[model samples]
Target: MRQFYVYILAKHRHGALYVGVTNDLIRRVHEHREGLAPGFTKRYGVKLLVYFEQHATAATAIQREKTMKRWPRAWKIRTIERTNPTWADLYEEICR
Candidate 1:
């Protein structure tokens, strides 16, 4: 089975947010955390995995990522808080 992911990364609780889609969530997030992505996420220090949703297709995941990027900051924060009230880093959780 193949999967794609729409994910949000944050600098910290209620802080700078970034939305993206990837076929490999673990590797992608790792790159962001390591400052290897070389863009907004690296420059803004938005490396904490705050929220994510899996999709069966890349099209759906990409669409979701695009939609999320357009969301207001408050809406993004609300969505994150709903799944991760503390905005905890989810990288470890996903790895295990």
Candidate 2:
């Protein structure tokens, strides 16, 4: 079965945030990290994958991403901190 992802990237703890959805989490995150994805995330240097959740379908993942993008900054931060209090770069973790 295929999977999709809703992910949040940050410049740093409590810094610029970006919400996105993709079927290839690893490749997408890598693109952002390398400044190859272009646009808001690259422009703002939001490369740290702070949070992500999987979904069974792209529609669900995209909807979740849109919902997260509309959330207030504080709510987004709280959501990230709930699972990632330290706001650690999750790229390495996910790669493993």
Most lDDT-accurate candidate: 1
Clash tally, candidates in order? 0, 0
lDDT of 1 by residue, 1-96 (tens): 999999999999988899999999999999999999999998898999999999999899988998999989999999999999999999999999
The Cα RMSD in angstroms, rounded to one decimal, for candidate 2 relative to the true structure is 0.6
Worst 10 residues of 2 by lDDT: 61-70
**lDDT for each of the candidates?**
0.94, 0.94
Clashing pairs in 1: none
For each candidate in turn, the TM-score is 0.98, 0.97
Clashing pairs in 2: none
* Local error of candidate 1 at residue 16 (angstroms): 0.4
Candidate 1, superposed: residue stretches over 4 Å from native: none
